[model samples]
Each structure stands twice: as structure tokens, then as C-alpha cells.
Target chain A: MLPLIHRFIDQAADQNPHHPAFIFQERSLSYGDLVLQANRLANVLIDLGVRPLDRVGIYLTKSMEIPVAIYGILKAGAAYVPIDPSAPLDRVDYMIRDCGITHLVSSPVRKRALHQLLERDTGLKAIVGVDRELLETDPLTCLSWEEVLQADSEDPPVKVTDQDLAYIMYTSGSTGHPKGMMHTHASGASYAHYSAMTYGVGPADRLGNHSHLHFDMSTFEFLTGPSRGATTIIIPNEAMLFPTRLADLVQNEKLTFWYSVPLALIQMLALEDIGNRDWSSLRWILFGGEPFPPKYLRLLMDMLPGARFSNVYGPAEVNQCTYFHVTRESVQGDQPVPLGRVWEGAESRILNGEGQPVRPGEPGELLIRSSTMMQGYWGKPDLTEKSIHIEEPLPGFTKRFYRTGDLVSIDEKGLLAFHGRKDRQVKIRGYRIELDELENIASAFDEVQEAAVVVAEQAGGDKELVAVLLLKEGRNLDSAEARKRFADHLSAYAVPKRIYFPATLPRTSSGKIDRRQLAQEYAETA
Target chain B: MEITKMPDKSQIESEIQTHFQGEGIELERDEDLFSSGQVDSMALMQAVAHLEATYGLKIPPGDLVPENFRTVEVMADYVIQRR
Candidate 1:
């Protein structure tokens, strides 16, 4: 068993030193060059006092250097915490402080952002800018990217076991705080090994990676691509936003495997005229993160007749447990695509409120047991216990299951159909959002006495977040200003589409905010 | 079918509104549909499909830039040019 994911790249480098490992922005890095750069960075990390299981932050935009930084952290026996460079400085500061991160790897353009974060007393010790430019007037301790690359091209001697942590990915928590999901090397490796096999990835395949590094799905490109000795093409951020450009990239890069949120596919299909383009090189198209609009899925199928589509379903906590391959028979009916069966080495159970297994054709909360399951939420034992449960031995086995909080029904054919979420968690354009987090951020505003956020369904069946705010007596609030304030703390997707200043908020019998009532009223009026 | 003349701005706006089923309000000719949240990615796709079918215009991938679809006036101009 591989103790760390970097070893896979090491083996690949040894086998095919001249093969292209990463293709980004029209530049290619061979396996040998990648490994040597990673090794040099690892030595630099060791010299910078990164120890076993220590958390290092990677706060850079999408580029070839991202893989180098991730593998370097892994080789140094430290888990990499990926922070979106575009995220608000306050949010970045919170993550750095929350995870006790002392060292950060970033690009030169983000030096000012790092300085702003350091001004908040985040205790960030050192910065490793991935560019050669030196900040002469910077107050924080910083190292140039060239200095790290100049270090010895020898792997650092770090004792990392399978049980050691690999990464800590942060997601929105129900209580408005960001929670880190901890994954050990074993868990990550399990996901990488299984997903690669499932996709039939090989050295000849060029995988398309469009997801940001902060997202969990990017792990497929970061870990699985190297493990399978395949090439990864990092889709530029601009291409990700513009679907037509992304489609052009698919043809230009000759990507064999593509994985991203369904929204990207839908956008590409909508914005791009691929009817005349030659997409013969494309083979597999896998999508998840949110439900794909069935109508658009059919259109996408029509566009890419040669590609095989798979609807993958899994939360960040459980990696990927179930997948349904899109077939003519599956897409023929009025029903949306069913989330197929569990992948190898993973088991799923649907249980009712009483923890009793739901019979076939019944709906219940989905629970997952898998080797790829996250270790736990970092530093939150209460939340960890609430999410994961350990059951007593049944016959000869003790089972540990993670509650998915998603309501699903397994049909008589053993195909799982997603019903809806069982909680306030919602997905907006592929990002998992907790409504409570948005409400908490809204209420934090000085002019707002209370806040409630609800998802409103439009005529087209797309859900939009609407925020209802109650102002304090004698306080004035501007909606645009409030939105700008909210943008400072939350992601742009989490910002409410419409803001309403209600005279008084509706309440439930127990005096809690009545979200359902608010949603209904808003829908009726707006 | 050949279109003898470019559609009026109001005609284009009404068609867009009908396509979106009146989800937005107080639409301006130059208002940005995306930034104003009048249309999301899904709605944008639906609008594009609707335009292609209704007007018999094939929008090439390169013309899908935001400048061409940012406003009703720009979209109408794009449709006229394509026609």
C-alpha cells in the first residue's frame, strides 16, 4: 500500500520520465521535472519547519505550480489546506486561524492579500510565493519561489504512514463557521485508486480538470491522474466561467476524460455551438456536485454522441460512493437519472428516522460506509459525533456510517433516486451552501436585527436564494450596501439574489424562524 | 425562412421576457442579465436555445462572449448581425 500519494508520482516519474504529467496554459511539465520540482519544494518545506501532520495552506490560483505545491506538502509529511485565492480576506484569515496554519504557499500577486491577512494577527509564520519577485517592503517573512526551486532535488526523508493526514478541506458549516473535513492518506488514496479504475483512466488518457483547487472534486485530477500515469490538463479559470471557451479547450486539448459540475456542461451546451466541432477525442464525461437538469442532459447527450456520461453522487465527506452510468434506457423515461450502485469498497444504507433500514422503493436518509470516508471534522468532536455513528456488531461485523443528510429512495431495480435534502444544506451552482451560514452572516451586520434565508424556486425550476432581513429600530439599511457587506464575508454564490426588509418575521410555534412560511409568502408575492 | 428586417427592440425584449416567463422585472434595454441576477446559467442556456429556435439563427461558440449577450440591445444586435 502506498503510504503517501506523492509516491505514485515518484513511481510514474521513474517509469516514464519524459511523459507529460501536467498541461497548463499551453505549457507542459514532464513527470521527471514535476517530481524533481516537488522534491526540491519538499526539502524547502522541511527546512521551513513543516513537520509530520502539520497543516500548510496553499493559496494560489489555478496553474501548474498548484500540483507542485500539493505534492511538495505531501512529501514533507504535511497536509495541504487549499484556500481559494479569490476568497475574501476575512474568510481566508478565519481559515488560516481556524486550522492553526503557520506556513502558506501563494503566488506573487497575492502578496498584498497575505499582508492584509497578517495585519489581522492570523499568526501566519512564513509565506512561500510561487513567483520569483521579492517584496522588499513586506513586513511578513516571505520566501521567493526561485529559492525553493534552487534547493536540492532530493526527496526529504519524512516518515508518513497511511494513517497520517493528507488534506483538510473546508466547507460551510451549519452554524455559520467553516468546518474542515480531515482525510488520511489511506482515505485519499482509496478514492484515487478506485475512481481511476472506475473511469478506466490510463497513460493515453488526458484528463480535463475544471474545478478549483478548493473544491473536493479537484482531488480526481490532483491524485488520480498521477496515480494512473495519465496527463492532467488544468482548464484555465476564464474557460471555466465561459462554457464556449471550455468546449473549445476540450477539442484543443484532446481531453479523453472530463469531470466537473453539471452546470458547466449545461453552460457549455447552451453557449457553445459544438454541432460542427470535432469531438472525437472526448470519451468520458462525468458530472456531480448537483442534480443535472434532465432536459439539458438529453441535449448534452445529443451533442456528444460519442461520449459516455455518468452521474456521480457523493458529498465531500464520503468522497464518491455511488454512480449511475447514463444509458439510453435510463434517460428514456421521465424520471431524472438514477444514482446507480455503490462503487467497489463502499456500502450505502438507507434508513428512516428510527435508524431502521428502509425497504426497497422507500425513501430515507442515505448513510455511507467506505474506506474513502473522512476521518472527522477537524477540532469539532461534537459535530463529528453528530454526523458519524458507530453501530453495534451485527452478526460478525461492526459498522460505522456517515449520515449523508440526503433523502434517497432505492427502487425495486436497486437504483437510487434522489428525492431532496433532509436539512438546510443546498447546492448553488455546484457549491454546497448552508442556509444557516448565510443567515448568520446576514445577522452579523450592524443594521440588521435578524435575518432569514430561504431558497425560492423560479418558474424555470431553478432555485434562487432570497434573504429577508429585519432592521433594528431606528436603523437604516441599504440593500446594495448590505449585499456588498455580505460579499465581504461569504462567497459570491452565497449572496442572496433578492433582499426583503420585512416588518416582522414569521415565526413557528416554538418561536423559531419559519423558513417554509417565508418561502411560501415570498413566492406568492414575488 | 429569410428575415427581411431586424426585429424591433421591444419585440426582442418581449420575446426574451416570454422565454424567461417574466421572472425579472423592470428590464432595461442595456441592463446586464447576468450581473442583475435576472438570468442564471440555466436560464441563459434556455434563452439561447429559445433564440436559436425562434429566430432561426445559429450562434457560433466564438460569439458567446458576454458582450454579445449582456443586454437585450446587444443580443438583438447580435441576432441581426447573425441573420
Candidate 2:
């Protein structure tokens, strides 16, 4: 049988039964306990009428239960779909209805949101890890964590191959609705294998999980960390909001591996007093999703001299494909490090808009044909077709490449140099934001007649979103209401920081909202 | 908004209420405001500025932990403890 994704954790449990599998708030779940809990939960899911290949939603904040839910779903031969616990109810409902997720594994921490979600007409058959009281309101099944912990620990009977679906991660699309990127066991296993081998993580390694459960960055900590018998330390969401607290977590956890977005490190550098901290245990640091600004990258390197750093690169469509290790000699002053070469098990091609190969050093879209590539966007075949390019190099043999949408070039050092996105999708705080999605959200509001969003370069060199709205006559929205509205639809980091009410927005000759002109105006004002 | 002393718990609570009032955010006292998108970084910093301005206490960034700033009651408690 091909190596299944959850088999990694199962094998680890067999080898290192007493080793810490996951850690939170100083509490450790041994591999033995983790396996049992996952088995029990898998049995509970199976009892809840979950069939093989069914999608289970994980609506949770960062917690130890996340790993349990993930492993349990995979053990039951089901695809786990992680939904952002903080997402708007409509968006959450959209994912559930769109993907036909019948069972959701969530913690009590999401009780408030889950209650609100229950009020919506979601066709969920069961919500695991919730209070029994919810049954009074919703007739569907609600199993408490106590039951999952106490249920039968015998492994459930299942037959799953690597080709079976494993998970679907949803991200904002340029279109109004969010899109789920589907990954099978084969893809997830490939990613875990490549990242674990690339970083050389092992049984003794302690991994700091800095990303949210829904974000693709968590793949490493969730899969690779346990696959290698490393103990994963989940960083609480509360700590993430406070940079000093996050620095405290890194020190207290003594995590050997730290993988997160560059924004996290930059915030710590800006807000924390690193001189007095004991973050000496960290040996490897990987940052991805967005470019790591050189000035802050240099500062982080100087501070964490004992740790090796890598600028991890790739889109969620294809799991992390490249890593640029940082050394004093590799990165010059304010010169960004190259994206490095693609790792084993993955190949890439740089093609221009005309779908032809670009010159060696010319910039073009990065297309990746990797074992880690997602199957496609869930329920959106047209979108999947649009996002990927296929070639028939050999008769009766076809090759598929996911278009990264990231513009890159081969630098003088023969490494990939990343330019910005090929489209209006700009990243803020490592979260992808399709500018048009923000506009669509604003336009949907009753007050907004038209809206436009622009990424403004702030004085400190950070990017801030500035939104201009042409409101309906006599209707107005202040920053607070706009914030609530936008935050209700998008992630916290994706909310536009600045709002402007113009009597009328600029327009092009074709009567389109001239975002270019608005962007220019904001740039001038900044 | 100048005061000679740290405000009482009620006063601190009222100030926090006023800060988030314009944003139309209503939450349980102990609910997680930060992660739920109810409180953005800009809003959090503004609340920090509001508390500092009203109570005349410089909140060191380290004190911005959830215990002190996640909810109105905790924020009030933190401010009340400052005296």
C-alpha cells in the first residue's frame, strides 16, 4: 500500500509510544495517548454515521484538540476540512454547504461561534467535541470531548490508499466566494516527507506551531512534526496577538523548530525585548506565505544567531516547494535572499503570459508539478482548470502543473527570485487577500454604491490597505461599522485599516472603478 | 480626559465600552476579542491609547497580555491593579 498521510503518526506511535506528540500550556499528549484518543474519536465519528471519504469540518481555535481532530478524521478515512473558527458565519456556512461537510470536530472554545453557526441552516449531521446542551436547540448530534476521550480506543477498520482525500484548505478567491484547495493523502504525505527531510526534524525536535489550524502553514507542525515523532507545541491565539507573549512562548516551550510567517518575527522584533529572553533552544526558523523584509530578516538573524533560518516559498495550491537557508554570507544588507531551488520530488517551469518558457533570468509565473500539489478547487472545476496548466509531453501521459500566480525569475545565483503577485492579490500579514474580494464585500453592503481597495506603502515600509467607498446618497459608514462589516466577511488581518468616503470614486473611460488611479492617489498621500 | 489617579473598575469598564462602542462590537465579558476579529490591532492599540490617556498609566507592551486587555473586565482589573 502507498504511504498514507495518517500512517506517519501511527508509525510514530508504534515506535515512540511515550514520546510527547503534542503540547499546549505545558501539557503533553504522549504518542500512545494521541493514538488512542484519535482512535476513540475515529470510532465516535464512525458512530456518527461518517462514511469513508466524507469531509469533516474542524472549526477550532489553536489547541491540542486540533491535532486530535485532524488525526482522528484521517484515521477514519475521511477528508478533514479545517474552517477558521473566527470566519463570518456566512463564509463558514458557505464552506460547509459547498464541501458537503456533515460532521465537524470542534472544541468548546468555539461554543459561542458554534451556537451562532447552529442558528444557520447548515446541513451538518453532527458536531463533535461540543456540549450536550446544544442538542436542546439543534436536533443533530453533539458529542462532548469527555465522550471522545472515554470512547472505545480500538482502531477502526478502514482501507484507505494515498490517493484518498485527506484535507481541504480554503482561501480567499478573487471571485466573491472562497475556494477550497483539495489535497489527498498522497499530496499531504509528500509535503510532510519533503519538509521533514529538508529541515531534518527528528524525535527529539520540539516544533512551535505558529499558524492557525485553517492556514496551510500548520501542515508542517501538524503532519511533519508528529510524523518524525517530534513534539508539536501549539501557540495559543492569545499569544499570537501579543508579540512579547509569543516571544515568551518560544522561550518557555523551548521549541527546536519554528515555522511561521515573516510578519510574526517582524512584530516580535518591533515590540519585544529579545535581549533578556532565552529562545536558545530554537535551531530552525522557517517563514513563508509572504516575503521576509530584509531589514527585519537581518535583525532576526542577528538576534537568533544560534538558529538557522530559511525563507520558505510556495503557494497553498502546491505545498511549500522551496527553501532559502540564511547565512551571514548568503544575505547582504537589505538584499533579499533567493527563493532557493525546488526540493526533491518537485519540478518547476517558469512560463510567461503567452505560456512559453521565459529566458533564464526573465521574470514569469512559477508553475509547479509536485507530488504535493492539490487535487483541485473543491466543487469548482472551472476554477481548477483556470488555475492549472496541463501538458502532454509523452503519448498517453499527461503532466499537470499548478500555476503559482507568483511572478519569479532565475537570479544570477541560479536561485528563484520572487517578484510580487501576477494579479491584484496582495498579501497582508501573510494572509492572501484578493483586492477584488474586499471590493466585492464592500459593494455588497447596503450603504456602498461602489468601493475600491488599494495597498498603500506606509512610512515604516509596511503595507496598509486603504479602502475608498462611494456610499449611497445620504448613507454613511464610519471606520468602526466598516470594520465590523469587513471583519465579519474576511479574516482579521485582511480587514482594511483605512477607510475613505468620497463623494464619488474615480472611474476609467469604460466606467470601471479606476483602482489604479485610487492607488496612485493613496501612494501620493502616503 | 486627564485624571490625577487611576480610575475605578466601573470607570475603566465604561472607557473600554466607549472605545468599542463606535465599532458596534458586543461580546461576553470574558470572550476572546482578539482572535474573533472583534478587536483588530489598530483597535487594540487605540484602546491602549484610550486607557493610557484616561488613567495616566503607561501600559508596557508586555502587559498587553489577554489577562489585561482581552476583555473589558480584565482590562478594568488591570487598570485598577495599577493603583
Candidate 3:
């Protein structure tokens, strides 16, 4: 049993030396090559003073070098902080200083971004995997990939326990500050083991990784896929924007398991003529981060009868706790596929505002205590303590349950159903309403492709709900009829006061609907 | 009678460069604009607005994919063909 996350790759390399661990474009990195190359990188990092539990930043695009940098940092007994190469230099500097990342692993392809970062006073010590041209500052050192690979292929002399910090994932906070979520080797390994066991992943499975390196979903490919010695085919960034190209990649790679947000799969279904393509190679489709529009999901289910769909439900704080297997029959209706029971090694509770359990079938905040949960928000003790509820059920042992901030309830079938977010609830003219509820009801209309509900500030600093909708091509809506339709399901105060049509809805980097952007747009226009 | 000159690829490239210049970003002719995280949906919208206003070509929702605007070169070619 591999209790250490880094040991997963070692065991895989021992079992399947020739097996491909990661494939990008036409290049492939075999399991043996991954271990050997990672060893060299570990030695270079150790030489560069990357101590145990120290944070090392990985600043590179979606490429083969990612897995190598990840395992290498782990082997050095250091936590790898994956910095988005495309992020602005200011954010990069903040993360580097926030986590005390003195060293970064990157490639020459990012020299332009690296050069700008070096121009700033970031207090960085050394940069690896790039040329000396990146060493703009006097104190900064650079080691090219050639120089790093010149080191001996031997494991670093490091012993890491399961409780050691393995990685720190930074998420944009609502307050405009970024919070890093620290995960230990125990949490990472537990999630990888539980997910692999639940999904019955084996060496025969070929996982298609669609999530960005900074996104939480990348864990399946980096940790879970390697634990079972399965191959991961990385869909490059170029392929993601083009659905037709993505369809070609799925067929050419023969990926057995596909995982991403619903928006990605929705694009492939809508833009690309995927009806002519064969999706027979796929066995599982896992979607999370946001709810899938049920209308498009129904079409995808019909198109890919060979695949089984699972609605993965969890916050970035917990990685993932529950997976609801979707069926062709379930998506036939407009209702979303329910969030299924919690997977093994996880426990959940539905609690109300007073920290008491809600009555069965009543909406409440979903709280989860799992081995797959994060340690806490990095360096934000107050925020960390606020997000979790500690219960000393036993004499000394305490169980921590993370408050998901999401509202949910158990159905008659004992399956969890998601409601709108608690923070998304707002009071308009002293009437409290959930914006997500209004958006959901409006989007359920056949002519509506997508809809977003936002709160716009009024002339006298009052707030009103505004609905920005994207209608299907050639579809028109009568505002009076639409408002009447909304009135059928929602209260008069809860209904949006105005509706605006847009050519397209703006999406964030991870492809979630940008509600904050919509709210600001309407606020300014109003 | 004033005759409007047909917009060429270089002219379109300059327009794209000027669009990014307003945002303080140095536009690369061949680098991926979208995946590089430099051009987000909002940023791409500005470029689309420029293309429509300058080239007088409507970019339908179907043709608004990244394949047509992956880079400055790609977006220029798209404008030339559409114009």
C-alpha cells in the first residue's frame, strides 16, 4: 500500500517501466523515464536548497514537464505550488512571497513571462529548467534543463511522512485576496486511493486530463492515475478552445476516462459535429466545479451511450467526496442529476444556520469530514478556523468538518440535491432571495440557452436583481411572458426586475459562469 | 466619391496590436493568445469588437471559436478572408 503520494509513481515505475505515464502532443514520457528524470530534478532542487516542506513553484504551461516537476518536488520532500504561467507577474509575485517559494521550475517556452518576473524584486533565489537569460537580477541564479538533467539519476535522501504538506493550491477569494489550501500527503493519498478504488481504475485505463494544472481536478491525473499505473493523455491548451480539435484528440488518443467541467463537454456537443464521431472508447465522464445544464447533458448522454457519466460533487477544500453516476434515463428530464452518497472514507452532515442538523429533506449547508480534506487555508488561521467546525466527539480526537458554503438537502431517495449557494442569497427591498434559484428557473425555459441573475445597485444605493440571459439562436422571448413564467415559480420580489441579452456570457479561466462579472456589468449600466 | 480600401492582413495585425497596446500588453504575432492566459473572454470581446468595427464583418457565434483567433496571425487571416 502506497501511503506516500510520491511513492505512487515509484511503484508504478517499478511495475510498468515501459508504460507511458504522460503523453503530450507526439511526445511520451514512460514510467521509467519519469522516475529517472524526476530523480535528476530532485537532485537539482536539493542542491538549490529546497528543504523539506519548503514550497517550490511550478510555472509552466500544460506540457509534459508538469508531471516531472510535480514528482520531483515531492521527491525532494517539498510542497509543489503550481503557478499558472499565464498569470500576471503581480499575482505570481504574491504567491511566491505568500508561500515563500524561493525556487521555480519552468521551461524556455515561458521565457517571456519569466523575464518579466525576474525584472521585479521577487526575492527569488534560483530558477531551474530555463536558460541563463532568465537570470536578470544579480542574486538570481538559473539552471537550464540540460544542466539539471546532467545530475545523477538517484533518489534524494529525504523521508516524508504522511502528515507532511505536499502541495498548496491558491484560490481567488471573494475579498480579492488569494487563499492557499494546504494538503498533506495523507489527504492527497487518501483521495487518490479512494477515487481510484471507487472508479475501479486499473493499468488498462487511459485518463484524459482536461483540467488546468492550477485547477483541483488535475489531481486525478497526477495522483490517482499514477497510483494504478494508468496512462494520462494531456489535452493541450490549443486543443481545448477548439471543440472539433478536441473531438479529434479524444478519438486519436483513445482516452477511456474523460474529466472536466460541463462547459467543456457542452462546447464539444454544441460547436463540433460530434454526432459523426465515435465516443466508444470512453467509459467514464466525470464533471464537477459547477452544475451541468441538464438540457445539454441530456444531448451528450444520448450521443455517448458507451460512456457512464458521474456528477462529481465537492469543493476545492475537499477535492471530491461524492460522485453521482448519471444515467441516460435520469437526464431525460430537465432536473439535474442528484449528488449521490458520499464515497468511502468520508462522512457528511446537513446543518442549519444555528449549527444544528436540519430535518430530513430540508435545505441546509453541506458539511463534510473526510481524509481527503485539506489541512486548512495556508497562513490564514482566522479564515481557516472560520471555515471548519471542530467536534471533539471522542475524549481527545477531534473531527473537522469543512463548511462547503453550498446549500443542499437529502431527497426521498437519500441522495443529496444541491440548492443555491448561501452567499449567493441576497435581500432586495428587504426581501431575501437566492439569485441561483431565479437563474435556474429562467434557464429551464426551452428557448433560453443560459441565464445569470445579478444584483445591481440602484440610483439611491438600493439593490435590484437583474437577469442577463443568452437565448438560443433564432429564439426570441417576450419580457412580459417571461416575467409571468418566472412569477409562476418565484415570488414577485425574488423575480428579476430587468432582463438584458448578451451575445455570450463571460467565463472564468476554469470555465465557470462569471456571475461577479455580470453583476458588475449590470451595476455600471444601470 | 471616397472609396474605402480593402483591409489587408498587416492592417488587421496592426489593429490587433493596437487593441492589446491599449491594455498594456505586447501582442505576439504567433503565440497563442487565448491559452497563454493573456487573452480572456473579456479581453477577446474587445478584440472582436475592434474586428467588427474596423473590418465591417460580422463574426457569427459559430465562427467565434479559438481556431479563428488563436494568434494575431490567425485572427488577421480570418479578417482578410471575411472582409
Compared with the true structure, what per-residue lDDT tens digits does model 3 show for residues A493-514? 4446678888899999999889
Per-residue lDDT for A1-526 in model 2, tens only? 4378777778998998999999988688999999999999999999889888999998877777888999999999899999976566778889999999989998776776777777888888798998788555656888999988889998899998888899999999877778899999999988998998999999999999988878899999998888788999988767777888888888888889998888888888887467788888999999888878787888888888889999888888888888888878776766677888888878889999898989878999999999999999998999899988899999989999999888999866668998878888998878888998898988999999888999987766677898999989988788768877887777556778778898988889999988878877776343
Residues A119-145, candidate 1, lDDT per residue (tens digit)?
688877778863434544344567777
lDDT of 2: 0.84
- For candidate 1, what is the interface RMSD? 9.2
Candidate number of the best DockQ: 2
Quote fnat for model 3.
Answer: 0.21
Please report how far candidate 1 places residue B31 from its true position, in Å: 24
> A-chain TM-score per prediction?
0.96, 0.96, 0.82
Candidate 2: interface RMSD in Å? 3.8
Off by over 4 Å in 1: A130-139, A394-397, A524-526, B1-83
Candidate 3: regions farther than 4 A off? A424-526, B1-8, B21-25, B32-50, B60-70
What's model 3's overall lDDT?
0.81
TM-score of chain B of each: 0.76, 0.78, 0.87
